[model samples]
Target: MPTQSDSTPTESARLLGRTRPAVRIAGYSAVLRTRALLTLAVLIAILCTLFALDISTGEFHIPLGRVLDVLGGGGSRAQRFVIFDSRLPRALTAVIVGAALGLAGAITQSILHNPLASPDILGITSGASCGAVLILAGTGGATTGIAATLGIPLAALAGGLLTAVAIYLLAWGRTTTGDHGVMGFRLVLIGIGVNAALLSVVSWLLTRATLTDAAHAQLWLTGSLDRSDWSTLVPAGIGLGITLLIAAASSRTLAALRFGTDTTRVLGVRIQTQQALLLGAGVIAAALATAAAGPVGFVGLAAPQIARRLLRTPGEPIVASTLIGAIAVVGADLVSRTILPVDLPVGVVTAAVGGPFMLYLLVRANRKATL
Candidate 1:
């Protein structure tokens, strides 16, 4: 009945031992890995579909077939113009900026061991917003033209980096002798205070500026893809690529750090140095995304948490969060353009969605703490 006799448990174990052990894992872990991969694949598919749809259903209303033809280099001149000149740039920017914010969020949350940690909440985005508002005010609200386009990103980057430095210093000082690493709660509290201060600064600038300048600054602060084009996309994409490489190289360190400072130190990682390096990478990523899209709200805050919940993982899934961030932005941009009576800024939609979700997280965390 048994062909060559069924192997015993011992025999099977011996056979497995003889095979490559590196790939072997427990059944539950294997299942989780498979699920995560499948989830990522599904998210990718969804994003691709949304991307095509985004290019398809603008004011001109090109069909999906024509969009594909244009993408494939086989469309009419007008079709090509509409696809390439008008719509494609915005879609690409949304995806790129979203992914950047997502990665930044993942790094911040993982490193700090706090689900609520995000660049937006940590004053980084507010800092970028402050820089952008300064530029708008200084230039008399000249948000268009060549100079303004180039200037905003640089200012935002500087502001974000400065804010990051400030936060690091403030959080570091609160660290006692017993505190082996940055305290997540302390860092978050300091960040919130900094965020409030920066927002006050932004508000003050807006009030002092002329009406036109104030309006322009307000629009940019709300986050929109109106400014995105080849020029913006190229530099932002490059920055994202560089930061992503740094994050990838630091993946093992990130993984270790997630287990807390003691475990990471035991694993021979220099705690403060590794944390600083990772935080720097996160700041650059957030700044780049903010520079491109003018501090798109709630994306960096929500993406990693959504991905972690989707994958049911203890730690944030970096790739999944990145994909989810792209999806959220692209989807929000789509809704902003098509579903509304008037075209609205992308951040408006995201804030609307993310606000309630954030409340839910706070409530859940409170309940857990009580329990």
Candidate 2:
């Protein structure tokens, strides 16, 4: 209805190969809502603040200004030692491990088309936990040495990959409608069975192990961070870097799969192969995170769902989910360390939060179905 030279804002932006009016720079542009961008910025700032508090607020209680000085390479020898050798590793490990779980959750939920789907549902976390428990029982509470740092993580990785493969095989089938695909429902059910069996095995091992070993195994099962160090941080960081690259590269294919198998196939993706590839990347991320943090329950489930709602994304929001996960885990750690008289595991806090949220989501999903 407009006359010549009166193009709409959207049209003008499109013609300029841009979407957002505020973020134009040298022929490049991006589309993002102002409120959403502000929300993201706030989240980032909060995360930074939390990360600082995590390193500074302990028995020693370094000030925030001093914490920044330490970070910028200006603290005393004692401050540097505490920040570099003790607190920094734990905080970084928590952030990276949470990022891994969030990315894995995003992948699994997208492919399965279920908000509840996660590494736990796929049996990866359970498998990793089982493997770690086995190691603890075998070593008789020897979690102080190099064996704990390397051996447990390697075992967890192996267990996660094996569980994923088993789930895929068990769920593979041609539907009665003559369509061949992996059934998500079947996979989840089979994974539940596997998890139960593995948990029983863990219990048996703990019963046979020394009391000290049993205690250690129980603490690990609770997902405590009593043992986080540079060793845990390094591997988690490496895995996250790899995951980010793979997820970015395969995002389009993953996006297509979210629309269902027919759509992915129509987009020229080999359904089985692409699924395997995507699932493997997710498994790697989940496994590495579990290896680092000992099955921090519910972060994987909560982070992506929270991110999707906060960002209002049609598909899974990978970056937002990762940030949300970091916030959840770090914040949980803070609460565990400060709020309670006794130290509770971060996993326990997350479970307490996520369990109710999950029930609410289910109720909502049911109500929507009724409507």
Candidate 3:
């Protein structure tokens, strides 16, 4: 008998399969919503257009047609070199880095049940920055031997992972019934404390460094894409691919989590296991982004919120947030590099714009409920 519960949202649906031609699998009948799909499609189109424009706006100034020709292997050697070797890497890096941060932010926020629970907020980016800055200050600005560029990313990744692990451990709880895991509010508080400490460490390191060393470290710490190239691109791309796979495989679990711990347990979700998996995946996503782009701020913090507002998804809008992150980064980078007479760091662009939006969101959220 078809249950009357079907009239409601898919919270009660078993799991829908082969829902559409290319989109396969899924839990919850409401997984595919029309407005949300349209929003995602539109965001993707905007991203592609921005990508073409980004490639075409450099010093050499290749037109859209010429950029397409070079991308399609029909342009002259000079055009090909400029498009493929120079501009494409920066634009692609921006997209992937933003997407990774956005996905991470969505996962973290959903897990914590708070809009402000992002990588930057949770001390992950601060930890990464501290590690990278340590290397820069110690090695005299990442210019000495293998310690220069290579050490920065490696140290940052390690620092982020370590910080995430610590936060999880500190937030872990034991119930009277013998269950144990993290609580959202506790995690946020611990993260804030850790972030402050890490920021102090970064500041101390910068102060100890020479002028040139400090300058290099500071520039990178701003999350600019200036240093991006094939080296950064390859690893960031691989990390994003792995992230998407993890996200797809864990969608049902994340959805279950959305309904609260009691409901999650009733629905057969191994609560501890699911949280750990999601948290680990999110940390890797954010850390990989920091490794590639030096902890680009606010993209992780703002993109997921934007996606949620736009798509109005019941569960975490992971896919939408990823696309929005990509779009945000590319658009911001374009503005930083083009509209401004000087080549401003992309991080500056995001922070300057996203800060006010974030403030407004906080005010609106406060109006709805006390925090």
Candidate 4:
């Protein structure tokens, strides 16, 4: 090896140039990470503000200070009762449900390579709704005692899982041979068919149900947090927590999967296996959230795309999407209670926003295809 002093100017500059790109790339990576962290912090702050507003604003409005004090264990009993007993559960439910939907949407869109993909469109939400509706119809809409607390959610979870299994099985065989895993196009088409069939089942159930039962079922189907309590919240929250951990563990694979199946397989990923695992996690998240809030619409479908745009990321940013989802639901719930003449279900507000967003996505995709 030659001594450093013996090297010519050209050799030194060539060596210097070789190292510069790596240094520059590292700097860019650091900047991107910082930007992502800052985005997450801002989203979290917004989510907290929305949560407080939601908790404080209701039929008997509680001030924000009192709300914070009560949360910190320093308020009057009435304030505590109102915050902890009544408003807190509903608001907390919105946060948890929103986070879950965001995770589901992010993962689904990433794995499928489709911006338009979401739990709602893939029949997962419909399955959960069907399960809950079936229970309501069977009980003549009088879900009281244990039924109210445990029955509906359990049914919804079962329904969602069953639907996911069906979609996975139906689409798995249709995937083209190669390193590629489940084909996104096939899954979407199959999911649409399943979704249509499930909707028909729901409609038939609604029609055959008694008038009172139909009314109750319809309300639940619209997705309301009015029924949220400690009983309903605890189990769903636990499930979501577990699912979140699993999702975080699998985040690296999801990111790789977004690069396309061939690339993912080249990275030594078991494409189909990983896809199924991630899809299962996403499905569970959506189901549990739906169980808690009765199929709150479009949060899953919209949150990831919104978060991706906000962060200016190439693909959906999972953590940011989760935070945005929580914010959207909390904000929507607050709007439903305060801005509207009558309290509408939070799902109504989400659908109003998501419908147009979906159409825009469809039109954008078509334009891309035509071009």
Candidate 5:
């Protein structure tokens, strides 16, 4: 019995109400999909740029065309040797170390639900540093030599694994859920203690060593890509690839863990098992990277944070982190080599850049907490 105009207004309102939710949902879906696609494209482009930069920018500059020819197996002997022999191993090593650190950071951050968590947070870097220092102090020669190469990497792995196990054990307390229960705060506290103790040991050893050994140890501690050879590259590449695959596969479980351990358990994720696996993977990744380069700092801490921001995702994106990490290290290495007249240590450069960013993050987090 209502007038036609009145009925028309009511119908229009109903149509808007029905369509609004649909439009909003469609818009959200489109945004998410677009973000994912953009992340992928950025990753691909960055990788290509890294490869080009690695081959083209060095003391003996190779033209882009010749670099491509070398890559394609159609270059002169000199070009092939420079590209394949000299640069390829170091470039590949950078990628392996960078990806490993990035993935490790992503896993640690997700599991801890703390953006500050990284391989260093668990004392892995400190452990590796201790091992390398010991080898340099104890072994009476260049720590980067063929003999020390085998010993150093093994020692680093052993040190990292031992430190991780110790932290896990010390943090574990009896709980109804399981025998090994970790209190996050307690774990972090213990890791700090371990890191401090290991650093003290390294300092003592450095003082006792000869001047030559001390200098070599200092360079290793600062971190460098100067000595990466086929020997270091092959093992690092194999380990990095394996760990990256595992991290990617665990992304779903990691996402569930952001809620809480109990929620992850409710979702049928093996919380304890996954935690152990991820921690172990993170330690191994960090260890291999340390051995390949030398405690290359901040890649593990900064790469994941940057990746999350770039992707604009709420939770950690492991794949995106890996890509961003690769870009970060390669880019940093390029800067270290080209920006400075003399070669700068990669670790020094990362620390210089990441140190400020870390302080800013800490301040922001503190302000938010106070508010």
Candidate 6:
């Protein structure tokens, strides 16, 4: 009973409505993909620039041309020594450590479903610190003849892994019924307690140790790139590779898990298994990075949060997080080296930046929850 003209216009309107969502979705998808690629490209450029600066801007002042020549295997002996002996190892260490911290932060945030739930937040870093402090203190504060350097990192890794396992076990409620927020809160409390206890132990050890040993221990606690050679780089690289592989493989599961256990389980995902694997991987990444870099605080805490804001997504931005983290740690290291005449610690720089950001996040989250 409708006129042809009216019917034709109605049909057109219906078609437009149906096609609009698809068009918008496609547009958004393209934008996200483009942004991700651009971010990665920018990060790579930044990393390369930082590496070159690290090589050329040091006290010896190696030329850019020579730095490139050394990189390409065509430089003089002095250039090779400067690039290889001084710059390459530090740069490589920064990249690996940053990548690990970023990935670990992303995984912890996603799995725990809390923006504040990073390795540092959940106590993994504190656990590692406890172990490192124990070794340094137990050796009477002397790294010179006590094999403390080798023992400390190992202890840190072990302590972090154990703490992670304990948290997971405690969070399991016969079938993983606890809310992620509750679990995260519990872990944070435990971590604080652990950290306090360890600090006390370290204080006791310092009092009993030799002055030289105490000074060495204090320096280690501050964190530095001076100890990062091929030896530290190799182990960190291996651990980072393994962590990234696990994260990539379990990404889908993590994405699903973000929507709550019931939804994830309904979609045929094994919630507990995936959670355990992700947590384990996070602990390993954090522990290795901590062992290498002396609890380089806030890289793990800040990287994923920054990635989430940049990507503007609900779930984990693994790729973005990794790149952002790499940029952050390397950038901080550059600042630490160049900004201060005396060379401040990398951990101190990260903490100084991260601590305020953390407060902002807490305030923002509180406002959102109230609304």
**Residue-pair clashes per candidate, as listed?**
0, 0, 1, 0, 0, 2
lDDT of 4 at 360: 90
- What lDDT does model 2 reach? 0.83
Residues 1-371, model 1: lDDT tens digits: 77756989899888876653234456422223567778999999999999999999877889999888899999899999988987899999999999999999999999898878999999999998888788877776555657555777788888999999899888875354476457878899999999999999999999999888888778878888986787778757876888789888888888898985567779999888988888888888888788788878888889999999999988888899999999999999999988888899899999999989889889999999999
Expressed as tens digits, the lDDT of each residue in 1-371 for candidate 5 is 76756657678888766652222464443223566777779797988787688878887899988888889989889888888888988888888888889888888888877777787766888898787678867764354556555777787888889988998899788644564577566777888788888888888889999988887788778878887788887666766877877777786777887776667778998877888898888888888788788888888888888888887888778888888777777887888888877789888888888899888878988999999
Model 1's TM-score against the true structure: 0.90
Q: Rank the candidates by TM-score, best first.
A: 1, 2, 4, 3, 5, 6
RMSD of each: 5.3, 3.7, 4.8, 4.8, 5.6, 5.0
In the range 1-371, model 6's lDDT, one tens digit per residue, is 76756667678888776652222464543223556566768777877788677767677778888788778998878878888987888888888888888999998888777777888777787777777777765664444323534565578789899878776666544435744423555655665565566666666767776776677667767766777777667666777899889987877788898886678779999776787888888888888787777777788888888888776778768888887787777887888888777788788888889999999989999999999
lDDT agreement with native, every candidate: 0.86, 0.83, 0.83, 0.86, 0.80, 0.76
Error of 4 at 243 (Å): 1.7
**What is candidate 5's TM-score against the reference?**
0.87
What ranges in model 3 sit over 4 Å off?
1-32, 140-150, 174-179
Candidate 3 whole-model C-alpha lDDT, 0 to 1? 0.83
lDDT per residue for candidate 3 within 267-370, as digits (tens), equals: 99998788888888888778778877787888887888888889776645999999989998999999988899889888888889888987987898888987
Query: By TM-score, is 1 or 4 better?
Result: 1
Pairs in steric clash, model 3? 142-148
Candidate 4 lDDT over 209-320, as tens digits, reads: 8888888888878989888888778757876787788888887788798886567878988888888888888888888788888878889889999999988999998899
